[model samples]
Target: MAAYRVPHRPEVEARARRQTQIARWVGLALIWLLVGVLIFLGERAIPDQHLPWTPLSVVDPIGAATKAKAARTGEDVAACRGVLAKGGLTYVLAEDSANGFCSVRDAIQITGGMAPLLPADAAMTCKQALAVAIWERQIVQPAAFEAFGHAVVGIEHYGAYSCRRIYGQQAGPPSEHASANALDVAGFRLANGEVVWVKSDWDDPGLRGRFLRQVREGACRVFITTLSPDYNAAHADHLHLDMGGKPLCA
Candidate 1:
């Protein structure tokens, strides 16, 4: 007599598949949770202003995380575009990719935003441009009204995307500007038609000083890196903001 075998059950197989999927999702969640923890510990944005990053964890224990990040970055840029449209912001989209040294593709040339602020012509990654829009909307305008009783009507910037090594050094890593990932703001024009230069007003210890400090700190919520006159002599004349994902908020 031949040995009898149990037949496969379709319902049981379906249950097993469901369990497998649940387990896979749980594992992914755990992996991202660990990354989130590391990000929280590593990020040092201003108090109450730490940015919620785009889940850009570099560790890919499963080896597929990189692909997932690429997909997410695309989604992030799309979301930024939506925000720009809804806010009535004005900008021109840029081509993707600068070079191996510059990761910015899908950049933008921002021409307008809250209070008519504009960036010098340069390819600013969609993420960086959106971050600036958010900063202006949520932080700069409100702070100006509160601190100065006037709205910020204009802003001045050195530029964004200089393609140089950090601090113009012949050696060392490329600066954030190399990839169009940073902006250097030099000053602002207020509703009262007063110009506040970062160099002159940074030490005012008055409403102008407080307003500058507030915006600088507020930028930490959007830009992962915010360097001001307080950071170093190189940044003494401007507030340097970048999406380098560093925990820097100087």
Candidate 2:
């Protein structure tokens, strides 16, 4: 066996080298192609500083509020900001307050868009703010369009971030409003200056009543609690929305 060894051909070695070179080039091309694909997808994720994707469609300048919300540990607040920005709604971040048993954490005072100044200016927690923003965009705006052929211009409300106990319950537990986690919406002003009050419209069998009920039901998607005139006497004049405890829709 030792004496039978044969020398390799020069052409065979040359052919092998050429094949190896081609394989290497092919691998490099594939890597470059993948890199190009990734860059394209990254660009598409946010086009012209806007997110046109579901849920995130309302966020302009993607990841804009990610760090800010993370700092306050308010995922809902951050999301609301994105929605507001995307919708071209402007707002100002308000000062947070901690006063004895009452505090408004991660609060913001909405400055523009939707019910800007109805009854009063209210401070809201991140969760409450997000719930209201979503309710406005997904429910109120669309319903308003269908009913009045005009957009909603303002909102009336009982208030948000009240430092008080639950209404009607004289004793035990504090209300969600104690921490700015709830808001009471009284009515909405249309683009035509028509005001729809919950007290009057909640009982109507027309579009106004139907729109109110539609929004109340839609609020259940973002708010953990939604109460309407049908709930009880105390809530007969407004829609009570909150984000705390168990999920409830009345």
Candidate 3:
């Protein structure tokens, strides 16, 4: 009672193997195609701000892609200015200037719209200005209202441009201020005429402290760097926000 068996043919086995391989390839191709179609459809359903591939608009609500999109503006001055204009930010291009390692090019002095940046003449790179606009509209104002039920009227800043190294050191890399790429926010003025100082209100257990911390957290989302009182003594009095160097939040 020997069982019947088919003779093993190397050619037939090889053909079967090739067919299996082909089937696998077809399956993978179909899977990839389906994935791509889903992504395309999803992009249409989602907001442009959330999609990394879409052109960035400063007016767009802050989303997962905002920081990445904002970062790209640093590379293109015209594009950054365009974003500011499209967002309805009133700004004038600053005269280009250079001083040794410090140079201000493609910089702008934002004059109106949103909260007024203190020190009426302060100027910063177009990219930094764009970040400030987005931050004020999307983060600062909203957080202010949510916390104190009052909108922010003005942003009090230490300054924007300075020809100096990091912490004014004689050596090492230049600070973002050297190129007007940073702002030291000292406090905020509310529509109610009350002011919230990072130096004083940061430790309060009330709305002011919450608002300040919330804005700082949100700044970390848009700016490449955010140093608060928690960072070190140098930043204890103001929130140091910048678009230079690596991403850091403290």
- Candidate with top TM-score is 3
Which pairs clash (backbone N, Cα, C closer than 3 Å) in model 1?
A: 96-105, 96-106, 97-105
Clashing pairs in 2: 115-154, 115-155
Q: How do all models score by TM-score?
A: 0.67, 0.67, 0.88
Candidate RMSDs in Å, in order, are 11.0, 7.5, 3.1
Residue 54, model 3: lDDT of: 89
TM accuracy, model 3: 0.88
Judge candidate 1 at residue 124 and give its lDDT.
83
lDDT of 3 by residue, 49-118 (tens): 8988888887788899898899896579888878888888888878999999999988889987789988
lDDT of 1 by residue, 1-250 (tens): 9999999899999999999999999999999999988777766442222233434321211122322332244348776676576667788877766665656677888777566544456568777776676677777888888987888887788988787888888888999898888889998888898988899999998888898999998776556789999989888899998777476789
Residue 238 alpha-carbon offset, candidate 3, angstroms: 0.7
User: lDDT by residue for model 2 over 118-217, one digit each (tens)?
Assistant: 6546887755665576568667888889987988888889888777778836575778888888889999899898988999999899999988988887
lDDT of each: 0.73, 0.73, 0.90
Candidate 1: worst 10 consecutive residues by lDDT? 57-66
How much is 48 displaced in model 1, in angstroms?
15
